[model samples]
Target: MSLENNKIFASVLTAGILLMASGFAAKSLYHPKDLEENAFKIEVSDSGVEVASAGAEEPSIEPISALLATADVAAGESGFKKCASCHTIESGGSNKVGPALWDIVGRGRAAVDGFSYSDALQGMSSEAWDYEALNEFLAKPKDYAPGTKMGFAGLKKVEDRANLIAYMRMQSDSPAALPQ
Candidate 1:
């Protein structure tokens, strides 16, 4: 090889060797064979607890029927601010990142005009919006409808979900009657 080519090749070879040596040295130094376990344990009890067995499904949260009685529409409207970025709750509103949510509480899933829904959500078109379903869905949209395109992480609070549903119920001219 020419003198310049030889020098370049030597430099490349040295770099590769140094990189490999550094990785090997870091691996040995960070995790020695004689390292002690540093994890802490917290004791738990099963008394009066409904613990699911391994490989068994855990129980879903209680129905939203109970929460509806105490639902605060004002609180729900405030909570909906997070959703406003993607959806417009105003009647006759145009679709944004998500479908306008006017009358959504009683509307069929994926029934919005002009807005395209993910296949995961479209598959649930047979179901109408109801308190329990809305509750479960708002708790975790992705978990409720796997593969859904909604980017929301979901509201973790039951009161928030109830309030949001209440606010949604108010958006409709003839809102579906609330569940007892």
Candidate 2:
């Protein structure tokens, strides 16, 4: 109705258009591509379904036994920095948040003194801490021993697990031989 009113309307319309255009540009800039290309597939279905991507196969996990043959003990010791907060590796090392890991290789499960082990781990007392067992346990502690108190998410890399186990072997009075 008035020139001033027209100018105000135009300003508001321009601002709205600019804001909409910027939103569209941002959406185009940050839109995620198909996760299958990144080795991830989303599966949805009724009854809690799982779906496999059409194009990608899951990567095979190399057995820790194989990797231990060439595992770098030094690199493993370096990697142990991640575990230092929860464990002490020295001989007769008192239990920390978790049990002392000294001589852990080939040791019986839940055998450490004074440290209270979760029932999940204690259930594994029939087994020794062999290479295959260590690999599985270290790869995913929760998966390996459900209901256990170990809070780590586990190592995702085979090489890292192998190296870490190798380093742990060296901490023992009688280091276990690497798996063939």
Candidate 3:
């Protein structure tokens, strides 16, 4: 193998070993139930398959098998169903395997009250959830906030994202979304 490929392979192997040794479940570390908790966005295709997008545009997608409009609360709730595994929807509620969704709309990364956070997520500047920032994070969870403990690929339906954001907004006091 080329030197670069070897280096890449070595890096991946080391990471895998370290993560495995830490005793963190693969789903928690690498397949976070909710990338949305990390403040990401979503995209959609005509067939309703999730796709990633650059800007937070509501792409045309078929109705969710349970059809959701991604840019609003109702749809967000529908989209958030995917994230229920790691997070909670109640505001000011205790942290789950991840954190609570209450009031996270304008909250910053790793801003939850008592949950243990990865250094990478905490290293981020204190900010709140907003449109653009959420979009970037949702497009690529790990890319948006490097070292974030979340491990979901992200929502791929723009309408779903919008709907989800809307729902998240209702969970918090702030009407406008903030960015971290």
Candidate 4:
């Protein structure tokens, strides 16, 4: 490697070591004074991400739609309520703040008409909203499609994401789950 590359690599290594050391010191210093309150932790799931308490004993809260087809449709539509502000639900509806939601499930990114999309989103080449891509997008829209206009923080609840996906699928003409 070049000398410049070595310098960059060393700087990154030093920063990582410093950060990890600081985190360990902070944990040791605060773990005792910190209250034993449980907080949510994030984890990756087969479909998307799931959250659970750091140390609390609780039953599994896997989204109902993740396993139950009937529940998925309900959750999906209900979840879309949060997204209605920027998107219109009607098929072929005029663009809202964002592109129209018509037939988006199996459609390619940046494929909408009339509406001006961010180069960030319009630049994406993802062919369509497949399950895996959709899950990641919903998990964190801004991150998955960086520079996209979506400002959603993400659905913290697995069920909410699953349900929302179910709802979107139904909205698409692609013969998704029949209306619940």
Candidate that would win on lDDT: 2
Give a tens-digit lDDT track for model 4, residues 59-95.
4334333443644677677778888988987776888
Candidate 2, residue 128: the lDDT equals: 91
Model 4 bad stretches (over 4 Å): 1-71, 176-180
Q: Whole-model lDDT for model 4 versus the true structure? A: 0.72
lDDT of 2 at 133: 85
lDDT of 2: 0.89
Compare the candidates by TM-score and give the number of the best one.
Answer: 1
Per-residue lDDT over 1-180 for candidate 2, one digit per residue giving the tens place of the 0 to 100 score = 999999999999999999999999999899776664647556677857676677989665468887777889999999999999999999989899999999999999999989999999889888899888888889889978989999999999889998999999999988887766
Error of 3 at 136 (Å): 1.5
Off by over 4 Å in 2: 1-61
Give a tens-digit lDDT track for model 1, residues 33-142: 65386466444466655555569886686678888878999999999899999999998999999999999987899999788899999999999988888898898899
Ranking by TM-score: 1, 2, 4, 3
Stretches > 4 Å off in candidate 3? 1-70, 177-180
Q: Estimate each model's TM-score.
A: 0.71, 0.67, 0.55, 0.57
Clashing pairs for predicted structure model 1, backbone only: none
Give, for candidate 2, the lowest lDDT window spanning 10 residues: 33-42
RMSD of each: 8.1, 8.9, 21.2, 16.5
Compared with the true structure, model 3 gives a TM-score of 0.55
